[model samples]
Structures are given as C-alpha cells and as structure tokens.
Target chain A: MALASETPRPRTWWRRNQQRLTPWLFLAPGMAMFVFYVIYPIIASFRLSLYDYDGLSAPEWLGLANYAELWTDPAFTTSLYNNVLWLVLYLLAVPAGLFIAIFLNQAVMGIRIYKSLFFFPFVISQVVVGLMFAWFYAPNFGLLYNVIEYFTGKGVAILADPDLATYGIIAAGLWPQIAYVMILYLTGLNNVAPDQVEAARLDGAKGWKMLWYVILPQLRPATFIAVVVTVIGALRSFDLVSIMTNGGPFGSTRVLSYYMYEQALSEYGYRMGYGAAIAVVLFAIMMVFISGFIWKMVRDERGVH
Target chain B: MLHLRTGAYAALAVLLGTTAMAQQRTLNYYADFDPAPLAAFEAAIADFEAANPDIDVVLQNFDHEGYKTAIRNFLTTDAPDLANWYAGNRMAPFVAAGQFMDVSDVWADNGLDQSLGSALASMTIDGKQWGVPYTYYQWGIYYNKDVYAQVGVEVPATWDAFVANCEKFSAAGIDCLTTGTSALWPGAGIFDYLNLRTNGYEHHMKLTGGEIPWTDDSVRATFAEWAKVQPHITENHAAIDWQDAATLLVQGKAANYVMGNFAVAVFKEGGMTDETLGFMPFPTINPDVARAEEAPTDTIHIPAGAKNVEDAKKFLAFIAQADTQTKLNMALGQLPINAGSTVGDDPFIKAGFELLSTTPGGIAQFFDRDAPAEMAKIGMEGFQQFMVQPDQLDAILERLEAARSRIYK
Candidate 1:
C-alpha cells in the first residue's frame, strides 16, 4: 500500500478529463466564429431561398418558386457551365504549382529571392492581379497582343471575343492561384523526410518515378490543402469576373458567384429570392465535393490511431 | 443700451429655439449627382431653413449605382426624405407597391406641366406622379469632328446616309462606331436604337416592357438591322470603356460614338479641342420611325419620407422655372429641360439644343433607363454578342426568350 501510494500514475485525474475537454476547448473559438458567420448565414440563406423577397418587401413565403425558376433560367445554366469550366481548368494550378516548385527547388545563389518573386503574385490583391491581366490582354495595346501579332500576323483581343473571353479570364485567375499552390508544395518539400528520400534514392529511384513513388506520398497534407484551396478559389471566382469582363463579351464569363451578383445586387434586378436559389444550388454542388473531402479526412483521422 | 441688449437676446433665443426644433424634425434628402447639384440644393435648403426655421433638410449623396440599389433597399430600411430615381419601367415596380409618396398634389399645385413639358412623363407611373422631377439629361450622339473630317465623312442625318458613312469609314480603316458593352449594362444603347428604328417607339416600349415576345417580327428585324453595321464598330469595342471610347473619339482613334450628353466632359478631359468636338442625334434608321433623335432630361426625385416636402416642392418649382433651368444647364453644359431655356455659349451645348428643338417626334428614354434592368442587360449582351458573331442570333433569341419567359411570368 505504501509502495502503491509512492508510485506516480501516468495520468492524473485532470489528465483523464483532458482528451474529452481539450478538443472542445481548442475548437471553441473557431466553432463560435464559424457558427456565427458561415453556418448561420448558410441556414439563413436556405430559409431565404424559399421566400419571394425582393429585399424590399416583407419576405413572402413562396414555397419552392425560386428553385422552380432556377430550372428554367438560361442565366443560371450559362453560369453553371462556366463554373464547371472554371473548376476543371483550375485543377491545372495544382500540377503547374508542383512542377514550378520542383524547378524552383535548386541550390543556387539568390534562389530565395527567386522563389519569393515567383510567389509575389499570390501576395498581391486579386484586384491588382485582375487589373494587371486586363492591361496585359488589352487588344491593340496589350503585351500579349504584341506577342501574338508578331507570331500570327493577327492580334486577337482575347477578352473581347466571346468564345475565348471566359478562358482568358480564367487564365488571369490562375496566375496567382498557381503561385499559391507552388508555395504550399515548397513548404511540403521543405518538410519532406530527407532520410526516407535518401533511402529511396539509394534504391536507384529518380525523376518522375522518384517523385511519384516516394516524394509525393509524403506530400499528402500539402496536396490536400492545395486541393481544398483550389476548389474554394474556383467557386469564389467573382473578382476576376467583375474586373476583367464582368461576365461579359455576352455573359459568357458569368460564373455562379457572379451570376448570383448579377441576379441579386446588380442594376439588372433585385431578384434576391432567385439569387438565393442560385446560391443554394452552388452551395449544394460545393457540399458534394466537401462531403468527399470530409470523408477522406475522417478516414485519415481514424488512421491516425 | 439695456433695451438693445434685451432685443438681441430675444432674437438669439428665437434662433436657438428654431434650430432646436429643426434638429428634432430633420429629414434626410438623398441624391446621386455631383457636387454642383448638391451645392445648389444646400443653398436652397439654407433658404428653406431661414423660411421654415423648424424642419431641417439632411442631404445625403450616393453614387449612381449605389443610389439605384439603395432606393430598392430603402423600402425596407431607413428611407430618405427625398432621393433621385430613374423614370419609366424602372419606377413602375416600386410605384406599383405604393412605396413612393404620390407627389401629384404638389405637382399639380405647382402647375408643373406648363413649364416641365412631357419631361414629367418620365416620372409618371400608372398616371400618378410619384416623385418630383428635379434634373434630367439628354442621350444622343457625341462624336469627334477631326476624325469625321479626316475620314471625309459628314455627320449622317438620314438612314441611307448613315450606312454609307459607315461604309466609307470602314473602307478607310477607321472604326465608325464605339461604345461600352463590357458588363452588358450602361452601354446597351445600340440594341435599343435598332429596336426603336425598326418598330418605332411603341414597339420598342412594348418589347422592353416584356409585353411583346422576343420572337416578335419587330424584334427580329431589329436584330437583322444591327447585324448590318457590325463591322463598322471599333474592333474590340466590347472591351472598351465607354469613357475610353469618348477618349478614342477625342484622340481621333474612332470617328463617332453614341452615348449620353454627359460624355461631353470626358471629351474635354481627353484634351480634344472644343472645335474638334461635335454633337448630334443618332441618324434615322427607318426615316419614318418618328425618332426624337435626342434622349431627354437628367432626373432628380424626392423619396418616400421627405421632411421638407413643402420646401422641396418649392425648390422643384424654382428649378422648373425657365431661367433657373437655363442657369443650371449652362453651368453643367447640359440642355435645359424647359423649352425657353436658351443654350449657353458652349458650341456643343448649342448644337445639342439645336438638334433637340429641330428634331421632330417623341424623345425615347435610353434602353438601360427605359427598359427594365433585366431586359436591358440580356438585350444588350445578346445584341453585342450577335454583332461580334452574327450566327448566334437564333441561340441568343432563344436564351432571351427563356429569360423573358421567366421575367414576364
């Protein structure tokens, strides 16, 4: 009994409560902010989606009229197509970033400066990025036009042409997005287990095979983060649309977010209900991707044990 | 000396008491114009303060885009005493809800029609005057004289002449036209012009109001007509800023531009010599369409809850007078709404007023202002897209029809 009393327990009573209480405490601040700003508004918007509120009238309960209208809306359809295009093309940022990060991972004098300069676009405001791209693509006066004219004998104003305008805007959007993913990969590469990499190298693995078989498997967290950011960035592509074309060259650039603005807040009309419905539809589409991500995360969490 | 001091104290007490009363019953007045109108309004409000000495007028200013949305939202929030709003179908939905105060009584009491002309019609909804008309502007053609002169193209007055002029400019490698179409917003006038010419004013109104279907022959013909002049416009105009288009005209990069008269400032800012600048109505498309050629009046309004409604009405009355309109118009280089208000010494203003007075027929409001916003956006984008690629008409119209069906329904 004396020896038992003298011995130290691995966990105290406080430690027994820690696993249960610590997570809640750590989560409290983020949870509070998330519930207040993000979750509550989403529920509020879903509630708002059911009403025929002009934002001026007392919100009238209109059942699913807003949702019904969405099915028939060509504007909604156009925006949906553009959004799909954005999502698909935005994935290029990940691979492009990875490639750039690999190229940048060289031992040279002033390499740090080169990396920061490469990542500079990401730090700049999207508005500034958009403006720079607009100037860069301006028909007769832009740098791209000068290059194209030198090569092709015809300078195409990319933003002014309907067939190419969305792509042009998307390209502008990708400039910074690629940089962001590159920085993520750079960080991931910095944390890469050199011992494991050296062991894999001793087995005569290198280049694409080396990256694929060894390096990338260790880059799981960075890739996951990069994917999350890219998906979110693609969906929230309003600034570039607003600045570059404003969903113009005939509404061809209208993404879901911009179309929602066009529907609700624009001089076009105060169709808050219609806009809310569009938002809900977009939210639903995002939720699909989100569920997949969450499922993967849950599996990873279980694997951690 | 004591008697004089007593008298001074009495007057001071009265002034303080009046100011205190005004503080309690202050009314907020909102507007969207620049400082000139606001300055004039504040000056008038001072006069109002000296007169009523109780009801204070709080002046609020918003940018034009913000004003449009704010007015719509104000029906839910703290509405201003008075505000500036557009006329036509733009005002219809709001007026339908009886959200705006009916100023017909004040309007009639002022004998507004005698002085204001049909300009008041812009503000009328369902035969009721909902707000007091304050300031309005004309929309028409603003052009570069040096470019026209260099290209040897006269400002076309007739339909045949306009097309020929466009052909000449195109042959000369000069872009004959320019306007903004980037947002499918403010720069939708070209589509409105084609519709106005093809079916005349009534059909233009009907089509824009969602009363006529998009598949209507009148609308089709309008699209057909615009497709003819597609090549004459500046290359990459869809990407050009309207202000920059005016800049282009001023810089001799383009020959002509169709926009509101407010662009006169932009031309001057571009360093175009005043003699090099010229203004005219849009050339007739059908010749028999009875085109006013000139768009009409800049607008101002009193919102739903004005504290100094009586004073505001008085100020509106004062502004409506021929002399005051002339003074304000001359100061701003805009054409005065009142008939007898003579154009000032500014050559462009003189030419603009000359076009307005000499032009025979009804003045139609520009598309974005005249057509409800949704139709305006769709119509403009479709027209612009179609102009760039003519083969898209059927698809454009189908999409428009889908949009129209939703909006109209």
Candidate 2:
C-alpha cells in the first residue's frame, strides 16, 4: 500500500485524451472522403434539384416545381413501373444462382473449370453481355429466333415489340446477375459445416428436406449477401438498359435511372432540376433497403459482444 | 515575417500570371469526324499561322459515334477552346444557355452575310448568331445503280415516281429501304423525310417546337404513309448501322438508301464510286412550298468559356474563308458552306450541289435535330413501333399526345 501511494502510476496517452482525440483521429480520412465525394454530392444534387439549370447554364430556382411536374408525368410513371418490374424479376437470380451453385458443388473431374465457365458471364463487361444477348435475340438470324421459329412456325423479334422489350432486356441482365449470385453461393457452400449435413442425413433427412433444414440454415450469410447484391443491382440497372435499348421501342425499357439521365443530361435536352427530383425519388426507394440493412448490421454488431 | 510572406505570395502570383499569359496558347480542336478533316485543318492552320504568326492549333478527333456522348459530358466541364457542332435546332439549346459565344458581332463585323449563304438562317436562333457554319450538305436518295439497273427502274425525280420505284424494287425482291433504330437517331432521319414531305417545313417547325399536337392530322398522315412503305423495308434495319446500310448499296443487295451527304464517304470507301452510285433530290410531293434553304449544317463555335476565344474565332474565320473552305471540302468531299465556294472536281460534291439547287422546297433539319429532343424521340419511336406493328398506331399517337401536353405545360 505504501509503494502504491509512493509513486503515482503513469497514465497511457489514450487514458488522458482518448475520448476527445480518438474518434476524430480514427474518423479523419474516411470522414474527409465521405464529405468530399458522397455527402457533398448528395447535398449538391438535392440543391440542384430545386433549379432549372441545364448543366451549361446558370441554375434557375423553381422550387418544388420539378417535383410537381414529376407527379403528373406519364413517362415517370412508366419508368417507375418498369423499375418495379426489374426489381421483381431480378429477385429470381438469387435462387437460380443457389441451385446452380449446389449443382456445381459436386466433386468431379474438371469441376473447377465448369464452375469458372459458369462464372464467366458475371466477369465479362455488362456492355459485352448486352451485345451478346442482343445478337442472341436478333430478330431473324438470332439463335433464339431460329429456335423459336423452328417450333412456333414464326420468328419472335423480342426487342421490337413494346410488350416484350422490357422483359427481353431483363433476361439479358439476368445472364450476368445470376452468375454473380452463383459465385457468392459457391463461396458460402465451401464454409457450410459438413457435420450438420451428416447429422441431418442420419436423421433421415432427404433431398429437398436436407437442403431446406441443414444446407440453407448454414447458408444464411451467403443468402444475406446475395439478396443485398440483387437489390442494389436491380436499383442501379442502367448500363444494360443504355447499351441494349436506350429506353426505346416506345420507351418501354426506361428505368428510373435512365429516365433521370434522359431528363437531365440526354442529347434531347437538359432539365437538371427535374432530373434531381427523379434522383431523389430513386434515392428514397433505395433508402428503404439501406435502412433495413443498417438496422440488421447494427443488430448484428450489438449481438457481436 | 509578414512582409516576407506578402513578398513571397506576390512573387508567386507574378510567376503564375506570367506563365499563364505566355504559355503559347495552344488551341484545341475537338471534332467528331475522321482524321482526314483534322489533317486538312492542320494544313489550313499552317497557312493561318503563316499569316498570323502568334498562335498554335492542335487537332483532336473522337470516334464519330462516341463523340456526341463525349461532347455532352465535356460541355459541362471546362470545354475545349473550339469544337464542332451541328447548326440549326441542334445548336439552339447550347446557344440559348449561353454555353457558346455570341459570334453575332463577328458575323456582322466580317460581313458573313455576304460570304456565307443566307441558308445560315438555320444556325441563327432568337436573333443571335452563336456559331459559324463550317460546311453543310443536303440529304437525298443515294440508290445503287447496279440494283436499279437489274430491277429496270430509273431514278425517280418526283413523289409519285418515288413510290412507284419502291413498288418496283419490292416486286423485284429487293429491300427498297434500310435504316437503323438501335440508337434511335438513324431511324429518326426517316421521320424527317416523312414529316418534310407530308407537312412541309413550317408545320414541322411548329410541331417540333412544342407548338402543335403530336397527334395532329398531318403527323398521323405521315405515319400512315410510312406504314404503307414499311413492309418494303429491310427485315432487321436495327441490325445495320447507318454505314452498314450504305454497305448494302455497295454489295448490290439493296436498291436504295435515304441518307444525308455524310454517307458518300461510306459508299466511296466500299468501292461504289460515282459510276456505281446514283444520287437524286428528295422528291417534293407538295411542290407549292418553296423556301429553298438547306438541311442541317455543321458549325464550329468558340465557347463563351474558352480561354482563347479571340484566337479560336480567328481559326474558325480562317476555316470559313473561301480558299480554305474549298480546299477542306475538296479533300473531305463535303459540300462547302460559302456561297462562292466550289466543290472542285469531286463528283459526289458536285451531285450534292445539284440536289440542293433543284429540290423545289428548302431543306430542313432532320426531325431529331429540328424538334425538341423529347418530342422528337417519342415521335420517332412511335413511327418505328408503327412500322413494326401498324395496329399500334392509334395507341402510339394517343400516348404521344399525352407526352406532348406535358412538354407544352
């Protein structure tokens, strides 16, 4: 007791100013980057949405006008409807990818090569994929056209029909998106505990039941990733739409992003303020998933300790 | 310490200002055409510098197809000193926004009215001239002589004859028309021709500028006529790029191609020279309206934000000079914009002049260029959808009218 009192214990640097300096120092670079690239742009876009600025000219404020017009615009409705269709159709990729991943998980000769081959579409540029699918669906001479003609006694020019054009583009989009989902599932399958599978098998679990009870339970982490990826992919489905259709065949394939681009910065004209309003709506839609994700992540963090 | 800091900043400022001032002011020439034009521009620049002795010019060419997208992004940032753009309705949005310099004083001061053709009226919107048209060429039918000969049809010079020739070609198992709708602009030209013939230039002006109904009777009639001719067209027009359609002419597979003067190079490159290719004016169905101007012309403008605006203007003015205009187009085989400018000995260029001079009505900017881009897109897509399935015409029109109302509001 005398020794403990005789010499005061030296405090750590953190022990003195840790609360004040630590959060800031840890946050400095990341916070700066977030401010510069993400936060500022969001704020700027929000501010820009209140204007009628064509990018080349000075901005003019017509507050709430862009939003007012957006409400009454038929094109916006068409785009929003198509976006919903993309979201619904895009969810198919996750399950399709899981089945593919499970099928390819069997041990066999050249299985690695087969897996990579399956993964090829996702690795290829979306632009190239769009072009290939376009060729595949090309009216008369396309491979799919020939196959359909062989059976139906007629050639189906999928892209030219406004009724079918959006679906055609979405099918092309799935070619790559499924491949991305498959790769994620393949990774998850590698980490799935074999002990659980063996126990479930001993308990007389059979094919679909085995998967539903044992395999899927172990693959939650991968499912989470796959669902999040699919959601974001569905939301940001612009590149393929641009390359394949450009929202053509009577604007049948126009999504919110492409429509926003068309509104604010297309060869047609610049309506920057109107474009920003469209962007805000899209952001609000995306925020739904983002908030859920954040809530889940926070729950997971709390559960971590 | 304060004095030293002030002196240091003053010296730095002087250094920067002086460096910026004497930096040998290199002029940037951003264009969408081939290297041939840039190469020619350099030769012109050589002579210009030989006279001025104080400026430098740098020529950059983007892939013709990609340049439009590139220029769109570039214009929002620090753009080049001088860039090439289309005149008429194409330049209006840019000019209206004041992104481009007002070259009106330059035009008046240089007596451009006396030098350039009165056809420059298309480039002038709202009484302010924003750019000097470097050159322009008219649009017309470029038919394959071999295919036409095989089908035993002569070049049609009148509206009735044009349809008759199309029927002849269709009967002979040849696709009379081929175009691309992949990007929408190529197919947009089809609407231009239809609208030009059906409604004439004035109605086109009112309709494209959001002044008339997209479902107007005249517009519907244009699509109705297009539907009749649609079946004679290629099976997959979207499969072919505009150049690829021209290649069909070269291959003797197709009967005719309706295109602007820009397509001559493609035909020539494919070995369909003057002897193999024949040209005619866009036949006038309504011979009553005779405005006698030209179609979409190309312009080169110095941006208001250009660092070297004066020098950029000097370069553009030099390009507009009679001697340079003659030489440049002579090499590129384009029609010159200057009134006294000659096409030299190129057959294609000479044919272009004949087409423009003989066509009873004035030329018009292509539908996509002349109309507001939004309305133009809807109208053109409506036409394309109609062509594929004529049953959709009424629904397409009603939808377009809805879009039209929104734009006007």
| Leading candidate by TM-score | 1
Candidate 2 residue runs with Cα over 4 Å from true position: A1-15, A149-153, B1-30, B59-81, B238-240, B247-253, B268-273, B291-294, B306-310, B358-360, B398-409
Q: lDDT values of the candidates? A: 0.77, 0.79
Q: Tens digit of lDDT per residue, candidate 1, span B66-124?
A: 77777776654666666667667677677766677777776688677766665766767
lDDT of 2: 0.79
Per-residue lDDT tens digits of candidate 2, residues A144-219? 9899999999888777667888999999999899999999999999998988888888999989999998899889
Worst 10 residues of 2 chain A by lDDT: A263-272
Candidate 1: segments with Cα more than 4 A from true spot: A1-36, A58-61, B1-25, B35-55, B185-187, B294-296, B306-308
User: Which docking class does model 2 fall in?
Assistant: acceptable
Clash total of candidate 1: 11
Q: After superposition, how far is residue B70 of candidate 2 from its true place, in Å?
A: 6.2
Q: Give me the candidate number with maximum lDDT.
A: 2
TM-score of 2: 0.88
